[model samples]
Target: MATQLDLQEQEQLDALKAFWKRYGNLVTWLLIAALAAYAGWNGWNYWQRDQALKASAMYDELDRAAAAGDADKTARIFGDLKDRYPGTAYAEQGGLAAAKVQFEKGQVDAAKASLTWVAANAAEDEYRTVARLRLAAVLAAAKQFDQALAELDAAKAAGFEALVADRRGDVLAAAGREAEARAAYEAAYKAMDDSVDYKRLIEAKLTALGAAPAPAAPAASGAAS
Candidate 1:
């Protein structure tokens, strides 16, 4: 009985060794890969948090400069903010604020440059649309009518469709295209929501332009072509 027990124990030990020999290297490499990935993920999270904190502080400085109407300081600080933290929402907001300050100071060219940058580079589509709208207004004021219309045509933000049409009417009217201006104003009036105060302003524009709003379609049929 004792000899039989010893033989059985030796067989079990040999089987365990064979299992380790077959899988030991694979297990070791898999564990190393998992640990490496975990460390990398943690490092990336820390890096993003650090970047955002620094960007927030810089944005606050830019905001203060803009509020104080310090165009030069606003421009300088915005330059730094955009260069160092272009990926942050702070950079986009700073660009818009800087543009507003410069525009108020009659630095039209500089304002255009800042607004163009935001239109091209903002991470959010809504910000891009706002930049484009402001840029179009500036271009129109400069009598660059075709360029203003081009900018408006390129703005595809859904909620801004009415505003874009309204701006287009203004540009077309400035260019002495009266028929097209009336049509554009009508389109703007139709696009605006009924409850918006701005819609009433749009209606007033249509009234002044001698363009009547399109009659509303029945509710069951919704909007008609």
Candidate 2:
């Protein structure tokens, strides 16, 4: 009986040896490849996480600089953020923030540069829209009416049609094209939400251009600024 059990064990061991001899190299390589892939995936995730944390910290610093109204500091931090992390959301936010701060601080050229980068490079359409809109504002303020109108004309982002029309009206008004200004204002009035109080501001713009304001009245959160 013992001899029979020994024979059975030896037979099983020989079968396993044969299987290993046939498939060992393939199995070993497959296991190695799988481990390498898993390690690479983990490494990639860690890199992404590290990038996000860095971007967040830089954005926080930018926000602080903005709160202090230090245009030079804001510009420098934003420049670094854009240079190193242009692919991050924080970089886009930094551009917008820099543009706003620079514009307010009377740095028109710098403001335009920041807005232009956002207009051209922003990953999101809405950010591009806002950048174009604000860039038009800056240009219009400088009385570069044609350029301002061109920017607005090129803006096709969803949900920004009203804003674009409104800005177009401003540009036309500045250019002394009252008729076109009125038409643009009317378009803006129609495109905007009737329940939105900002419509009233658009109406006022129309009225100023000798056109009646929108019939439905609502309040405003922000208007053109």
Question: In candidate 2, how many Å is residue 61 off?
Answer: 1.5
Query: Could you tell me the lDDT of residue 166 within candidate 2?
Result: 89
lDDT of 2 by residue, 3-109 (tens): 98899999999999999999999999999999999999999999888987999999999999998999999999999999998888889999999999999999999
lDDT on C-alpha atoms for all candidate structures = 0.90, 0.91
What value does the lDDT take at residue 46 in candidate 1?
A: 95
Off by over 4 Å in 1: 1-19, 214-225
- Kindly report which residue stretches of model 2 are placed more than 4 angstroms away from their true locations once superposed: 1-33, 213-225
Worst 10 residues of 1 by lDDT: 213-222
Q: Which predicted model would earn the best TM-score?
A: 1
